[model samples]
Target: MITDLANAMSRCRRTLWQDALGAAALMVTLFAGLHLPALF
Candidate 1:
């Protein structure tokens, strides 16, 4: 039972980390898209 719980926790952590990275990448893309137009 403890091993199963530990495995679940690790999976959750990995999912959270992936989500955070995706969100950060999205934000960076959006910021660049919004600001890049002003350079003209």
Candidate 2:
């Protein structure tokens, strides 16, 4: 039973990490899109 709980927690952590990385990538893309044109 304890092992099951640990496995579930690990999956949740992995999902959260993926979500964080996705959000970071989106923010970076948006920042570049908004600023890149101004440089030229």
Candidate 3:
């Protein structure tokens, strides 16, 4: 049914959004880790 397809699409979109946020956080963590030692 169309409703099932819509639900699947929404779930996929949410998963992708979460993955993007996780990737951004990981990048920020890595950037901070690499630079924090220099600041001390």
Candidate 4:
């Protein structure tokens, strides 16, 4: 039972980490897309 809980916690942490990375990438993409025009 303890092992199952640990496994579930690890999965949740992995998912949260992936979501954070995805969100960061999306923000960077949007920021670059908007800022590129300003550089000209």
Q: Using TM-score, give the best candidate's number.
A: 3
- Of candidate 3, the 10-residue stretch with the lowest lDDT total is 9-18
What RMSD value applies to candidate 2? 5.4
- Which candidate would rank higher by TM-score, 3 or 4? 3
> Which lDDT values do the candidates have, in the order given?
0.92, 0.93, 0.93, 0.92
Report how far residue 2 has shifted in candidate 1, in Å: 21
Task: Flag the better candidate by lDDT, 1 or 2.
Answer: 2
- lDDT for 4 (candidate 3): 100
Writing each residue's lDDT as its tens digit, candidate 4 over 1-40 gives 9999999888798588888999999999999999999999
Off by over 4 Å in 3: 1-11
Q: Estimate the TM-score of every prediction.
A: 0.64, 0.65, 0.67, 0.61
**Per-residue accuracy of model 2 over 1-40 as CA lDDT, tens digit each:** 9999998888798588888999999999999999999999
* 10 residues in a row with least lDDT, candidate 1: 9-18
Candidate 4 collision pairs: none
- Error (Å) of candidate 3 at residue 25 is 0.1
For model 2 the TM-score comes to 0.65
Clashing pairs in 2: none
lDDT of 1 by residue, 1-40 (tens): 9999999888798588888999999999999999999998
